[model samples]
Target: MWLRVGSYPDRELAMEMASKLRNAGVRVEVKEYVEWDLTEKYLLKGKLGELEEYEEAQEWKRYADIIRELIRNGMEVEAFEREFLKRAMPEEFEIVEKARSDEITDDELVDAVDAMMKLSLLLSSVYGFLKANGIEVGEYIQGNLPEDPEIIIELDDWAEGCEKVYYLDFVPSYEISVDVLSAIRGGAEIHGMEGAVVDAASRVLMNLIAGIDETNDIEELKNYAVGVIEDSKEFDADVYVDAEEVFEIMLRSLEKAGVIRISGKKVKFRR
Candidate 1:
């Protein structure tokens, strides 16, 4: 379970909270959110944890909100509390949907619970929906989400009786490793057969698209992706971009909007 604490002007500011939370023994993930209303850029991050119970999770979330409110707004804690509550409740709802894992992925992503409970359904509904409508979702992804859990409401094919439910890690395939991608983009090259950076990049993209699930990474996937490329018709004839090349191209594309930068394999994003 993750508990979002407060917004910061930069990672440095967020790190201040992270430092405190670390001292208090909490896990943290610093995420950069793209802000639409602000002229100056900022970031929002929450301390994260994987507690066994929801109550423990909520307890820490409350603690984080109090402490971060002190840090971000000083005496205006009341206002901070109000905003946090507004954000926290819905965020918790979002988190609950995401709690489900991918051993349960499918086209609809929602499991049908009942007609009135359309929101709680996942997996079977998506499969049934696409198949019936003659619509197609990707093999691995099947579909993408606006955020995690990626809920799709109203399936009258929308079967009112059955609702779609996503209840796990609900990860999407094709999420690139910002770290490696950045290194490659920062002009760090890797040697892979006679392939160019594009080839490596394509492999990386495939892994992301597949959204390989594991507590620890299965390195063999890299080899498998590479083998597929090697067996491809353009095996050695093209100046195939390696993973790094793809990273460079992708990051550069992102940079056109002032959202990112690559330095020595590090990715710093601004929005």
Candidate 2:
């Protein structure tokens, strides 16, 4: 008999349940069971059965679709039981659908994508700034690059409850290119500003983008970035970050500090 081995609130969960049922000597099939208990996070009322013949299986599948529509529209177990109690199809069909509820349309996917793009662009700009400041922003990435540099990072969008968040996992032993490093290093070297934009951008990216989530004031983070670099005397991920992100942040900071006016990505330090 073709039997629904499991029912779930979501396709993934249903698949998992069906897999386990298959392993347990049962003919498992995944079915989307809706009309869940809002508080319990599981499907509430649904009918499932075993089909004995090919014709019967097709008929069951067709009937299940009608039931699916009912559940999706919010059916209650008590109401369904009261109605179906008079006519019993089978004992297993009396069983309630249960599984972790999930949304088919997760908005977190979009939010995560946007967040990552913003972060990547910010990182690239900051890295650029670091290079302008005489700091070797790409040194770490160049050193730690994986077997493949182009595929350096994997972007993941995840749901944190109802909200979607994005994160990046750098490829094994690889670093993201902070492309703005060269420009920022130049700015620092020409102006002799003591690590200059690189210093400022590094600290900001470390705190904001990197996992080092230290709460730092603008002045402190700027000093931290420069100090870490000057002391280490090499490209360091522990304190250093994508120089490009730092650059964008520094432009904003400098504008805020009245040290320069950043217009259309061109930050002109006031002479």
Candidate 3:
């Protein structure tokens, strides 16, 4: 009979422990165990309601309410001019009011709202990516959005009276680096050499592993992995990777490596 020696929330750490035990000539089988009870589940449900997307939606609604109140008080752009710039522009205040009153008919307003929504989602996703990569926002740099996928960040205090600007273009490329190849190989090793697929799914596997700790929701993780691959500049342009295929391969590979175990809708890391 195997005895439970330890439990870990971190999948990578659990895998490391399993590897060490196996190397010491001790039999080890990493298994997933759920310890969440009713109270924990209730807490998690409450936390889910406070997610960033929900917060952002609430913020927009508040802005709309404020704009409507300003219109009622006979103050339009003047109110925004005195206050700090919110996510929406001053001119968008009128648009918001018009939208709320069902008076919005201009295609331009529709396009503006569409663009704003897209930009908001893009910024949120990029922030998460930067956080995962251990990059701190407002540390030494400030981001300026001139357009979609083309962000220019100004780095402060680089040298004496010298300002450095870094341009981050979230566009896919055909070039693949050696580091990416190594990551792909590492992912493949989880399920043996023959389990590897040299397509787009293989590329996504690398990012999926990196973002494993970001979320326990497999569907969300799969979407994030796909989005990362789509925005990456290191993807091979010639290869086609399916999102569904990537999710399937990712789950199988991680499970085979004893890094994770899927039970119903929950994915628990081996401990």
Instruction: Give all TM-scores, in the order shown.
Output: 0.16, 0.17, 0.24
lDDT of 2 by residue, 1-271 (tens): 1212112233444354334333333333333323422221211111223222223234334333333343344435445333332232332222222122332222332233334334334345334323333334321321221111111111133222223323343321111112223323233221112133334443443333232134223333343333334443333444433444344454465456455554553334455
The clash tally of candidate 2 reads 28
Model 3 agreement with the true structure over 80-100: per-residue lDDT tens digits: 323313433445544544544
- Per-residue CA lDDT of model 1 for 19-99, tens digit only, reads 443433334456665533312222111223433122323443443443344333233424433343435444433433342
Residue 132 lDDT, candidate 2, scale 0-100:
35
**How accurate locally, in lDDT, is each candidate?**
0.35, 0.32, 0.42
Please report the candidate that would top TM-score against the real structure. 3
In terms of lDDT, which candidate is stronger, 2 or 3?
A: 3
Question: Could you tell which candidate, 1 or 3, scores higher by lDDT?
Answer: 3
**What clash count goes with each model?**
49, 28, 0
Q: Once superposed on the true structure, which residue ranges of model 2 sit more than 4 Å away at CA?
A: 1-237, 263-265
Candidate 2 at residue 183, lDDT? 28
Q: Which candidate is the best by lDDT?
A: 3
